[model samples]
Target: MSKIAQELASASTNTEDFYADLKPFANFEQLTNFDRYLPLPDDWFIGVADVVQSTRAIEIGRYKAVNTVAAAVLVAITNALPRLGFPYVFGGDGATVALPGKYLDDVRYELARTAAWAEDSLGLVLRVTIVPVSEIRAAGHDVRVARYAASENVSYAMFTGGGVAWAETQLKKGEFAIHRAPLDAKPNLSGLYCGFGPIPTEQGVILSIIALPLEDQASYRALVADVLTLIEFSSRRSGHPLPEGGPLPSWLGGEIQRLLSRDSPHANLLTAAADALRAIKTRIVLAAGIRIGRFEPSKYRREMWQNTDFRKFDDGLKMTVDCSPEIAEAIEARLIFAERSGVCLAGTHRQKSAHLTCYVPSNIQSDHVHFVDGADGGYAAAAAKKRRVRLPRGTNGHYRANRSIDAGERPHRD
Candidate 1:
């Protein structure tokens, strides 16, 4: 085995704190620095959950439902393994997580139950699967991960080495697929919420982008750095989709969806009434900027903006940013030029506003994380648009014509 692979194998023997042991880098721009990522242990496993026909659902204005169901996968798993810190990414319509083999069965059960609940309650078919890191390596790819500390309490995972992309492709082809649990099965989805309405862009539009390298790793890294530099040059906070004060709760934002996700016998009128009251209370707190017993509204809002996964890396670069018409056009032009030069393949979509899906363990804590996407159609649409184009040859002499690059479909926030 290679030296790094051997080290990873050794680390697998004591896997409990593998993720926690790695030092985290605070800057998102350093994502292109290959040395920051470490190979996952050979014994680790990757779990993938995807929503089938998500594009169709988005077309019918069910984007919020789709985003909620996608985020639910991670929330369920996290609640199940509260003491363990794992790496996960949330796609607009799906999610991917990696954990030690010791927790494999537990995670599998949660994922199966989550799939069952999504279909039964929301009418969304969630495909779930688990693949070993060894199996991925055997297929000629590796899963290397990095930690981006978005806040003091939250650090998002950035995946490279292409193993995640390979796993998603296999899952879609019915390989290593996990059967859904019984219809009545339920996963702990305690903190999942889609309470905020779409944020209208102060910038001209919301742009969703997905870009992949068509050449060597070095070239791809340079391309990513260039793209980030362009964004920073436009405005240091141009990529932040939320406003300075954070998002406001909508009357019909996601209360019904949250209520329906529960399978408890007590999920009746009284339960819904209680949830509605909580929502009203939250609105009042945010509107008045009040502080109530350890939960400071202003401080929470600042953390929410900082904690959002607006731009992330999962095998490739995926971002949802709010920018003006001129900035968006400039980005698109740069991507097109890079594509023509055989450096990368990219796709972008534009909308008037951006959406937010949140997982708040507690309003009093700054550890909560938010997921961002274009309100109408986000990464799924951008990926679909990308597949329509003919791809170029890589520096390694491989033609990507028949290869599917949409495998890494989610946001990268643990």
Candidate 2:
């Protein structure tokens, strides 16, 4: 009816108030039955950043490092172009961000820098690719998307139509692989943090799972609904899945306050130094527990909320959860049941604690978000588990039967 809707239906991407239109469907109640998300216009781009040979890295105990690289791309890009708004979805190994055409060059600069840093600092092969939306449409796919606001301060971009997936496939195939640049400076990752280890909980356990859908959207949606119902019950019986006191310890907040320089990458020496001074001052204030310029625990908590990059939807459903032991058991049972009943392909992993990686904006104490995954292995491991299921394909074209370990079968998490 309206121009935006018309453009969306016709595969034209518009970021202007994009999430506002989808706010009504942000929660599971409406999203499970919604018609479809909007499609992107030709004037947009899709970026996929990931660690090459990530599975091998995970196997070799570099899983957390891999996550750093994944969130690093988003942090670098967003910091580089703060004025331009975009939507991003985090995969445990990498991330997918969509934005208008104007941000492409800046995005490339940051991605190159990030890839270089991953290789240089972390010894991980980070791959990045940026392709125009038109290229995807030409390949006979669409990048339909929805905004899922998990909390009041956080919203993730969910994708359908297979275009975003196609782009990722291309990147994996080395078709559009953007390589690392030889830069003297590291990617601007000032506020990113990993000093705090996994938050301890009573009977602490992290549950990671992936559920792939068949073509029948309703069936898959229903399956997600079932999973949510279990989680809701568990939350009522136990506490919220997120850490209750927001990852304890007095020095924790200070440990995460990074000094960021907001001067333009092209700024003069004087401006750069001034920005650096400002950053150090802010970090000192935050680290010392002084509340100036909205720099306090409440603000930090919101930053964490905005960046809770655990639950996401792409070709499959993925999440890294922390819950009470009993709750974890009940949720696992439901996944097994869903798979056995032909709802979707199921892949799951259980661990002691969830992994956390952060992306703090140029401001040390504000505009930060934390990404979470299962500690030993997160989404990447779960997806690997899903791939091993040699089950019969159901009518929905998904691998049938659940491959999740029975709660009693393994005590690896316990």
| Candidate that would win on lDDT | 1
Model 2 Cα shift for residue 78 (angstroms)? 0.5
Task: Put down candidate 2 lDDT per residue, 126-179, tens digits, no spaces.
Answer: 889998888887665667677776666556677765566667767766787777
lDDT of each: 0.80, 0.64
How displaced is residue 335 in candidate 1, in Å? Answer: 0.6
Off by over 4 Å in 1: 9-13, 252-263, 386-414
Worst 10 contiguous positions by lDDT, candidate 1? 390-399
Superposed by TM-score, candidate 2 places the C-alpha of residue 10 at a distance from the truth, in angstroms, of 7.0
145-219 per-residue lDDT for model 1 (tens digits) = 889998787899988776777787778888999999997787888887788877888878789998776655566
What lDDT, from 0 to 1, does candidate 2 have? Answer: 0.64
Question: What number of clashing residue pairs does each candidate have, in the order they appear?
Answer: 3, 3
Alpha-carbon TM-score of each model against the true structure? 0.92, 0.77
